[model samples]
Target: MTRDLKALLASDQTALGTWTQMVAPELVDLIGLNGFRFTIIDCQHGPFGIETAENLARAADANDIAVALRVSRNDPVEIMKALDAGIRHVVVPNIETAEEAETAVAATRFGPHGLRGACPCCRSGGHFIRNWDSYVTAEEARTGAIALVETEEGRRNIEAICATSGLAALMIGPFDLSVSMGLNGDWRCDEVQRAVTEMARAGTSAGLPVIMPVFAPTPAECRDLVDHWRGEDVTTFVVGSDKILIAEAFASWAAKLS
Candidate 1:
């Protein structure tokens, strides 16, 4: 499969994606088919079993949506498992140092940088076919490894992390970053805004795209951010999470009933 992610980001296209907590295969398939450019199978906080993850990956593939898995940690086992299940893109959360970023790159690969045990039975390895070598090579070329920088320390180390050769992008996890900076959920605080802006500049200077997850906000607010960033032409935005949508909907309904 052609990796359109890099191209999409490069072209300054508005690629819409969602973060899913519902990891069921059917739901994943439905979301993908509904025109989501990509859907993240959130393994970090979402309830997703290995088998279900595999099924969801397959469904996303079938529906022509890119499957990116958000691993809870920067563990090699979790990274390899997600890759084995045919997830080509990975978002590793809370990467605070150059060492962590290096470790993440290693985990995503097969030999040099990582200790990933190759399994021919895995979907990514072509089920151990005679063409396994070709499969691995091609897969390696298309795979994306994103580092989520969500801390004051991570912000400080942004340049080093962006300089890492294999890193595809630097993702800003605003919530965690806000808390880390003692903003305590005040994402609009001057300190938080400055940090995010500097991080974006660093990533762009290093020739890496910056990705930001836009949480629950009015459509106008979302558009304003998108327009601003899109004008810069170096960042990709993933619209709000499914969990937030569900909560908002329920809260609105409760208000109506009352």
Candidate 2:
């Protein structure tokens, strides 16, 4: 699965996926079966607890799709819990320094590099092996981490953040990044564009893949933005959220009725 994401990132392929606050396993199964390369469980803004997140992860796994989580904060407990729930990849928001990035990596990794609390009985550890040595080695190899470059602080420290080893990729949070640039929701501002471009370059230099979230004003606009980003060599594009799809469909039907 990591190989697949890496391939998409390397070749700049358009990976279509959605963000969900709803942690229902059925929804996860539906999305995964539909051939999404990945599904990001938005634990930060969504009402997902550890149990629900785990269920979603299991559902995705059953369908052979990668299940990733976006943490609410850069807290160790939050990062550790997500990893233990069988989420192979985690996207941490608002990372501002190499130290924070290091902390995140440590929380997700096993001994030698990180201090992630040991849990032999957890699903991640294959259910509490009596022999500790084998479990630790396996855990370290499976987990992956991603740092979000959202705020101006994170953007300014892009090179440092990307320089951290064990990080899988750097993701751009369009809304947050736009606000951080003082554009206040204006994603088209020249400053926002320049910052994203710069960050993409930084990711390339650091040997990390860059991911961008596209919340377009319209479906046509979404396709256009995807094309533009693909041209720039951004392989992973999170197209839209479930909320947007529902609201747009409902509004369109309502307009037709009216």
Candidate 3:
């Protein structure tokens, strides 16, 4: 169902997702329809306006896929816009402290619980055809706010960050984290591995699960990676993106043609 992602996350069950870097709604639908439990609409690097993002969100939901938006910034407007577009999950990047995590959560809710502006006519409120306040209350209950603990500073403070009340999960930004630790993009380096392990431990201690990313160059490699994380006790992971899938397929085609 559309609530599958939330249910899985809430139950501490394994939730699998895929990245959507392109603005194409068709790709979003296909990603969800392909059996992924969730999809992250990457707004940070993907050029999409509120309308386009909303269209994509609707597409994913129509296929019974939960949608999350990795907003461009932790700014309240960016977060609000994402939710207003009917996305139930919001991922804020580069969160290094509890205060930042709180802010991310605050941006997703109304007053008392949060500071999100309320509008009855928006997609979030069902276009003013229903009770606005009731809609806000219900939507917040279904929402998940995830914090990206990417940098060295962020990883060091991960426990406290995860301790934020409304923050749902800690998402590892592998590339940025590798660069932050001076690993020079060596995600496989021993030092980088240690950092990853420590970060996961911190989240575990805080009573939160870490959202890991599974990246691979081939389908078999992807399966192996998922199995490895499952053995490592990773309850949630996102598969590689539409971009990576196309790249892999194209590379294989070029090799065969050669």
Clashing pairs in 3: 110-114
lDDT of 3: 0.80
144 Cα displacement, candidate 3 (Å): 2.1
Q: What TM-score does candidate 1 get on C-alpha atoms?
A: 0.90
| C-alpha TM-scores of all predictions | 0.90, 0.90, 0.93
What is the per-residue lDDT of model 3 for residues 1-258, given as tens digits with 9 covering 90 to 100?
Answer: 145456666555677788888878888877767778888888887777667778888888788877788988889888888887778888899898899999999998887778787777777666673676677668888877899888999987877897899777888887788999887877767787788888877777777867887776678977886776666667788888889877887999999999
| Residue-wise C-alpha lDDT for candidate 2, range 1-258, written one tens digit per residue | 222344455564568777877857787677777767777889888886778888877777777766678988888788888877767778898998989898888888766668677776777756666878876776676676789988899888999999998888889887888898788988787888888888888987788888888888478998898888777777787767767766787889999999
Please state every model's RMSD to the true fold in angstroms: 2.3, 2.3, 1.9
Tally clashing residue pairs in candidate 3: 1
- The residue-by-residue lDDT of candidate 1 on 60-101, one tens digit each, is 777887768899899889888888877888899999899999
lDDT accuracy of residue 215 in candidate 2? 89
Candidate 2 has its poorest 10 consecutive residues by lDDT at: 1-10
Model number with the top lDDT:
3
